[model samples]
Target: MNQNHLTTLLAVLDEGSFEGAADALRITPSAVSQRIKALESDMGRVLIRRTSPVAATDAGEILAQAARRMALLQAETDVALERSISRVPLSVAINADSLATWFQSVFSDVAKWKHATLQLRIEDEAHSLTLLRRGDCLGAVTTEATPVSGCDVRELGTMRYRPVATPALKDAFTSDEGIDWADMPVLRYGPNDAIQESDWRGRLPERPRERRVSQIPSSEAFLEAVRCGLGWAYVADLQSDPLLETGELVLLDSTHVDVPLYWQHWRLQSAMLQDLTQSVVDAAKQHLS
Candidate 1:
């Protein structure tokens, strides 16, 4: 495949539109469209779907993955040969909870590395593997233990989550007959978040008739919502520990969920990627259960 065509394809996908891609590539939109057309003709397949915000077809995803890998290798080579002045971009996916806690240390360590730049895509741990499979990210901190094709996996340890709420909310919602599942407000990270539901599924006798749920997507804000008596939530121990000790938040139940996390990355022979993996493993050791 032509390098310029592949680069143009990536720009369009990354920027989400041909016009946006033209701006990114410093070329006319007509030029961008022509390159894409030429590449499609060469490949004999429709790669990009011409929709609002645009999307890659199955073949497009495959090509995009290859393009990203090629870009990484070229960037590494250029830096090694002193032929490029730009730092290598390392894209990785991480969950919101991990980003707000154990993963912060990874950022701290990476900041000291001068030749690499970190680009993070925050997704739910269970779904982060999608980004890896799509090649939108080169590495991921995910819940899936099974490795994607051409990738390697490592166990990072378990993240324990405790059902917690403010004292006032707990007292109001619980009694001697057992806690009320219905009518009590609950918190979730987002629609994709199953942490709260999974934690309650095994404990409850049956599904509640009515569930009052508030979706707070931001990690820091989600924790704060729990502290402010918005609702009960299954919070990671990393964020709940200090609050539990200080009586700012109360554990609502004894049963806890331990989510095992793993680091999945492309099987590459790059020093920067290896260094990043090592840094992540080291940080996970100190924080996760």
Candidate 2:
């Protein structure tokens, strides 16, 4: 494969358009288009889809992932030779709740490393593996224990979420038959979030009908909304512990959700990635159950 062509393909995908890629590569838009066409001809496949903010075909993703790996290797070589080199990009997917809590330690640790730059894609823990599969991220902090193809997986730890609400909200909703599930407002991280419903199903005889739901996509905001009595939610113990201690939030029940998280990354022999994986593992041990 042509290294220049592979680099061009990655540039186009990253910039989302040929013109943008041309500008980044210090070349003409026509030159960018021609290079893409030449590369496609060589590979005998349509690697990119022509659309607004263009997307890569599956073939393109495979090559783009290869290109990213090659770039990282080159950066490492440069560092070993004591040659000037740009910081290597380390893209990883992480869940919002983790980002709001224990993952901050990873950020602090990365800040002191000068040879790498961190790029975080915040997705739900259960679904972050998709980013890794699509080559959108090099690694991910996901709830998936199964390893993705060409990747290695390690157990991080479990994050515990408690069904909690403000004291006022809990009192108003609680009754002899337990809290009024149907009428009480509930908070969720997003439509895809089912922690609240999952907990309720295990505890309740049947699913509630026409339950009121509010979506707060951000982790910090979701906790704050629950704190302000906006609605009850399965809040992470890391964030709720202080509030629970200060009497700002109370557990709605004895039930808690324990989500096991795993670290999945490509099996590569790079010192930078190894160091980063260690940092993540160390942090998870200190923070997670």
Candidate 3:
């Protein structure tokens, strides 16, 4: 069945009237009627229960769900064809932080809609590799040093972070704690971040009191909190560049943490994965240090 028929059926169920469905679908009522008739004839069943506010017949509900799945699969197929070579599907598991700040430009450069069957899932970097190990994704941008079995690994480089603060907050915090990082309130990306714990403890003059902690799950929001003066944060280089230039935030000191990243993928001879891997590596080489 065509997309038009599937969409028409869904719209009819949503709007609850043939006329209303037609208006929502931007098709003539006759056209909507024709498509529904075609779907009914094709399925050999009465799919919709016609009413003032319509409902799907049992069969209609089944077909509607199937149609929704079909549309999603079709989109995947279309993206694969337009994105990369045939015979390979593109899918990935990644941390939300990387997706929000740095990874989007990789897709923008491909310039085709059907190049690969792109599947994307978001997880934390501390945990994304589990998806690959379970065979869900072909590759990942992760902090794992140990490669998953059947996959090869490459060092992508690091995301450098330093403590940062707004001037006013720094002034108040310094007055209270005397500019020692150990005693300051810090913002963490998540419980598993391990970043500041790795970098700051024992290195600072005073033992860290960690006055208060705030954790924002997404990369974008975590940085935004720092930019808004919520707390001191370990914002990455690429993430901090603009804020530093604009003078919204300042580096706490020369001390920084480098979150060494790696690239890992199934060692399969698929053209689609190969191209994607190469592109991502190229981007990493240019952007990460």
Deviation of model 3 at 133, angstroms? 1.0
Residue-wise C-alpha lDDT for candidate 3, range 75-94, written one tens digit per residue: 55655557443323456887
Query: What are the per-model C-alpha RMSD values against the true structure?
Result: 1.4, 2.0, 9.7
On lDDT, the candidate that comes out on top is 1
For residues 170-246, write the lDDT of model 2, one tens digit per residue.
89988897888667888988867868767666766876667777899999999999999999989999999999999
Measure candidate 3: CA RMSD. Answer: 9.7
Candidate lDDT values, in order? 0.92, 0.88, 0.74
Best by TM-score: 1
lDDT of 1 by residue, 41-140 (tens): 9999999999989999999999999999989888888888886586888999999999999988988888997778999999999999989988899999
Distance from true location, Cα of 244 in model 2, Å: 0.5
Instruction: Name model 3 segments beyond 4 Å from true.
Output: 1-89, 110-115, 180-183, 203-210
Model 1 weakest 10-residue run by lDDT:
196-205
Q: Per lDDT, what order, best first?
A: 1, 2, 3
Segments in model 2 whose C-alpha atoms lie over 4 Å from true places: 200-210
- Total clashes for model 1: 0
